[model samples]
Target: MNRINAHNLACPIDGALLVCHDKQLRCEHGHSFDIARQGYVNLLPVQHKRSRQPGDSKEMVAARARFLNSGLYEPLASRLARITSALVPENRKTSLMDAGCGEGYYSDTVFKYLEDRGASSGLSFIGLDISKPAILEAAKRNRQITWLVGTNRQPPVTPASIDIILCVFGFQSFEGFRHILKPGGRLVLVEPGPDHLKELREVIYSEVKKSRPQDLTPVMETGFSLVDEQSFQYKTGEISKHIIADLLLMTPHFYRTNKAGREAAAHLEVLDLTVDIVFRTLEFQNP
Candidate 1:
């Protein structure tokens, strides 16, 4: 694994500043973390861990990997890459951090886009997740980028070190994101729109709760300025039973689906799923 500048790291043990010496990251208080041979580091302290295994289960990870590899979400990835690259300046070497990168699908796609455009050499990608297994799997696929097992509450990266941050259909820690982003750094958030997967939702639950779409005013209040927004809707042609099962496992709806709903999905002949993907780009504001 490549050794990152310790100056860009913080002590997960005490939240103190970290210093790098001889390929090791050490805190001012003498706490130390070692870089792994695979070119990544573990910043998650044991005390902060609530479980022996954190984050998505192995089964969920496998299901997600399989579903994503099928290229069902390739169009979404392409849009993300296009928007993110447009926001970043071409002259500067950029660093992108995916706060909840699961299985590295989107991050890998974005990195490949930069490479294909001859812009990858100046860019560094980091995928961070609370799930150790997910990070481990991501490391195997992209050796050039960094992978860390950590939480969004206290991102392991040093303050003001990131140029672009991505939060894609995952958790978001607005305060943590603001702390790590450089001045004028960009943050891209991808969320499921109101009409997202309505077909699946209708089948999974007895009563579909209709709530107003999320308001971005609160997000902007947290020291970010929204720059651009776009919405895309597409129908995923009739899907098979096996694909339905994988989709169930890959989303939170699995647990919320009623017994009747599951039975319906199981017996259904085909599913024509519709997705409304929303993307928002925000920039960090000066304090």
Candidate 2:
């Protein structure tokens, strides 16, 4: 197996090949970025930023780290590992990128699972997120994986160089993904199913509304054809108050629910949560 590192990164400003120097990445025409001591780089340029601080906040990331580390979502992580590992190109160096990987929980688990299954020899991993705090926490998960603070609109990677990209409940542009994924590359998206967290929503919202399935038409229009999709659902029979709190803090519902809704959730001593998620694999239809 060839040892191909995750050096297929590009300058966020000028899109030139980034060569690593001592604790820094430098591209031709003098674009440079310093790698943080925690083993990640800030590839997001200020000009491309929508705000001074973007994506998940520090508190949110901390909550996510706590919740994910609890192994409550181990089933989902296992499914992700199985899907991604099977997509690894036979006997060739494969590059996997987790776009919008928050704190790298899923990516780290999947990467390690692949490694333990003997795929690490020819696999390179990159975890990118717009949130600095999220990427900072992600960097601590695995030093071998390249973690970068970046966004989906302008991913700091070489065009047409990636083999697989995993976007888990993240906002993204399939058209932009087309530029980074090579011909026949696989793009896996994990989305929340309609019944996901229904129990929690029932308690928080005044009236629970069913969620619609993600539309695939727009994604197909972006030159991606759906390959396969699978759904996973399970119930956590009984979870404690703190565990529920951690779950809430890690999700968008933390902000979406108002004070009364939050108070309703907090008052519950025990809760049963149904975890429903979908994993969809799409192939880029190169012209």
Candidate topping TM-score: 2
Per-residue lDDT of candidate 1, residues 1-287 (tens digit): 66462246678877787776765678889998877776667888988688998888888888888888878888899999998778667778887898889888998889888888878777767888888777767777777677777888789877888999999987888888998899989989999888888888888887877533468788787789989889988988998888888888889888888788888878777789887888989999766
lDDT of 2 by residue, 24-114 (tens): 8899989999988888889999998999999999999998999889888899999999999899967899989999999999889999999
Each candidate: RMSD to true structure?
Answer: 2.3, 2.3
Query: What TM-score does structure 1 among the candidates reach?
Result: 0.91
Which segments of candidate 1 are over 4 A away from where they belong?
Answer: 1-7, 16-24, 37-39, 210-213
TM, every model: 0.91, 0.97
lDDT of each: 0.82, 0.89
Reference-based TM-score, model 2:
0.97
lDDT for 146 in candidate 2 is 86
- Top lDDT: which candidate number? 2
